[model samples]
Target: MITAVSELVKYYSSFVDAELLKAYLAGSRSEERDPMEHIEAGVQWICQAQDAFECGGVARSYSMIYQPYFRKSGWFAPYPETTGYIIPTLIDYARLVNSQELVDRALRMADWECRVQMPSGAVQGGMIDQASSPAIFNTGQVIFGWIRAFHETGEPAYLASAIKAGKFLVSQQDEDGAWRKSLSDFTMNSRMSSYTYNTRTAWGLMELARVTGDEEFEEAAIRNVEFALGQQLENGWFRSNCLNDPSQPLLHTIAYCIRGIMEIGALMKNQEYIARARRAADSVLARLRQDGSLAGRFNERWEPAVSWRCLTGEAQMAGIWGRLYQITGQPDYLKGLRRTNAALRKVQFLRTDQPGLYGGISGSEPIHGMYGRFEILNWAVKFFLDAQMLELSLMKKSDIRLQSNGLGDVASAN
Candidate 1:
């Protein structure tokens, strides 16, 4: 009991700055603001994270408070797994905003990834400083960057890298479509055998299949997705899905699973896959509070398992909801998208003097929540920007559809 109190005191004492204290006390709930402003701030934070790392790849996170145990703070080393997927977001944002600098920066990130890739064609797990070892999930994620880079520049090098990574993924995959080997060291011990969330990795393989016209990649992706679907309960909660605890899975992994299924469904034009994804998405949507916040974790029964909010998962779900709106023209999904995005915008610190806190989404709301615990995560910002961009694009499309249907004034009001 004494140790717990001491730890709490230490945690609070780390917030030495008055500004940080003020921001913390302000909490994550606030009035709706412009998403584009938040998007811009998110992009700026990402750039700073990259610059701080001094490598083309973005840093893993920015510590907002001091950690007495680790005696560490500030920007962390570049993470290959997230950095791989972040490439596509950077490229999409650059094109949307017409920024050549960001485009070049993303290409450099891809090059850095290529430099550090293992001879086995698999990307290393954890940060760059970690011992070099092949990781199945990491390799699958980096394939995303190479695929996008190749499409953007018609670069043979990017294509070659993607093919190699895809081959590695295919080789590691089990006949049942599960990946039982070369899992990320960061995953919990209980989940080492297989992860349902690797459906996201399967999505990466599917993307490669689309680019290379390789039936092998497509078949492997299908097997993995099928394996993941088998883990989904009738209520849409997935078993053996969480990185830490399967009994109570983090919403971040939940969103990842749904997104993989959704994307693959769309790519393959399979309505069954889309419907299955919607089942899970809808279950999650039902858990949204009236204030638009959701619990960071949920149990197998789809009950809230924590008080804090996983901001990363919220942003991801917003994008998923937005996509569902586009696919089905569902009003509830549209409403959920707007509500969640607005909630996210409110929490974004647009006026902060601290560059680390400015524009970067915290891994969890309240900052000190267990998910990321006082860190602004790179992937959090990446997913936030992606969601905001999707919101903007979809709203514009919705407006056009409404206008063409003779609801011009209604569209104008929105």
Candidate 2:
């Protein structure tokens, strides 16, 4: 029978394997040819992910088929409205590349100041935006993205939207500091086998903490983490995952969840959250291999079915490993980082050289997400840059400094 959170390790192992980390440990899966190739490929992929989104901020998707046909593009381009997702991604890309165009795109999407605000004033757009009112989760995502853009570029356009979004989110929290289910529909569309609105709601709060230095955001984020912790299965796993995009639980979302908790742990200087992270890390590492590739999906029997690997599984895992290294100072995390990144390099799918053009991602892998396959490819650019720049930055900051100093000293002595 499944035991306590720690003992029910078998169920939780899927999260670890979600990123295909086995390949990292194997080490022979990918060649370390040109590092720039990976970076370039990542940039190309991100551009493609952006292209998938049509005008009016609609994702240009179909019915259950979920195929985002490029030929069907521009359908929504003329629409004056926008969605929540397109904005955050634009902001993230803006920060990573220091691109003004991305920042501009996000701001332009937010053109309607307070008019789009629901009674709660949160910014939201997604598949649901087409029908039901704005969702808290989607609003939070866009708000979080706009806040990042503000923090990165200091554009007031983004900040105005963020302030409304952040305050609205803070106000929406239940008395316990956690957000309730849905407010716009069915008092919050209560379909979750496990509570994720509160779990998923942490991003806007956490981002506010990072940008505003506000304790409320930090406190609110911890409350959601606490609520999510309460929802952990008997085997220490979370279910009732994303009903919106129901395929698999991504390591990135898991990482974000852990990060919210970790941030709270850091803010309060609490070790329990750190302990919690270590637990999750071990749970994930349990299924990881040296080659950096992880088993995509697992059966109820706890055996990994290799047929499930996808682009998202790797990028998200790479992020988690990097953060693990940050928290623990373990080189093993870096090895995981290198392996997963290499594997992603080998297969950067679903993107053309230039975005805003004819680009298509094959609608097969993870057939449930047919067109959205390239979504993860967009994330690879952001994470791959981290893998390269992490060590590169250190080398630049200290080693490069010392070498320059040494040369100056030698020249002076001569």
Candidate 3:
């Protein structure tokens, strides 16, 4: 603690003005007063980030500019894990807006992923070229992209790669449905242990099964989901979940687990699994601040472990809530969707002049929290774009329902 304090005292002033730094250091929780809804602005921000990604070599994420701490500038290598799932978002948006550039960009990303696939069919953890070792989570994330590409263009290569990845994941799974090998070092616990959040792996595998008519993949995915469900506490909190820290699990991982379960439930037509996801979602909803942000970490009982907000988690959870609303037609889920998505828009830097700040979402609120401090994460923007897309899609569907009932205004339909 003393070393941490000394480091903070030494470099805090170098990063920001004293007042802002002081507020962060003091752990202030002041909310934005005049938050507004700006979906178009958000979409424009997404475009800017995409341009920046291309400037950064279309690998994955960029560091924006030089950091006083690292003293480096320009874009870094593309991240394999996030670059995988980002494909679907890019393709969907491209279709929605008729942007050929984005479609081309998504293709490039998908092609890059195919080039980097290991002989074992698993993508490595961390940034590009970090390691040759395969990681289960990273492989699943990339598989999601490969399958999406196959669906978009009927490219046999994309399908072949996805099939290879799915086979690797299935081979790695233990008889109990837990992945015992190929876990990433990103977790704080022992590297050999399995993860609750690999419910995402199950979801991705399910996608592979659906596209390829592979019953083995489907059965493997179901087993993995069954294993993940065993980790959920009666209170709906997931154990052994976090990218970096498990003692105080990040909302990001919690959201991952919840979304994966919810998706599996939807795909399998299992109301019981959906109810499990709703239980966890309600636990999170109870903790959301009036400003639509959540604490970055939480204890097993669903209490806040930190004052800072994980912006990525907020966006992911918003998407989950939107999905829930679609399934159940619940008004509260709609309210949560609007409030959380609006909060995200409030934080987006809409100025097109600065490519890095515009459309890029920070990893943490106040921009100096424990996770991804001072850096904009690629997955952050990907999930934010996803949440916004879901929100808009739901709103449009709601509008259509209202119109069919002879009500022009959303308010009247409510």
Q: Which candidate leads in TM-score?
A: 1
RMSD of 2: 11.8
Clashes of each: 0, 27, 2
> Which predicted model would earn the best lDDT?
1
The lDDT-based order of candidates, best leading, equals 1, 3, 2
Write candidate 3's Cα lDDT for 1-414 as tens digits.
986666666565445443334334532222333222343443454455456554322434444334444444344466888888888877777776778887777888888888888899888877764656789988988888888788778999999999999999999999999987888654436632777888888889988888989999999988987888898889988877776666678888898888888887877888888999999999998887898888999999888999888999998888878777777778888789778988887666543344555456677887878766755677887788778777666766753322232211211110
- For each candidate, what TM-score against the reference? 0.91, 0.66, 0.85
Supply the TM-score for candidate 3. Answer: 0.85
| Pairs of residues clashing in candidate 3 | 59-78, 60-78
Residue-wise C-alpha lDDT for candidate 1, range 254-319, written one tens digit per residue: 998998988888779889899999999999999999988899999999999999999999988987
Candidate 2 local lDDT, residue 297: 45
RMSD values for the candidates in order, in angstroms, are 4.9, 11.8, 5.8
What is the clash count of model 2?
A: 27
* Candidate 3 deviant stretches above 4 angstroms: 1-60, 64-74, 185-192, 399-414
Q: Candidate 2 versus the native: TM-score?
A: 0.66
The lDDT per prediction is 0.83, 0.48, 0.73
Number of the candidate with higher TM-score, 2 or 3: 3
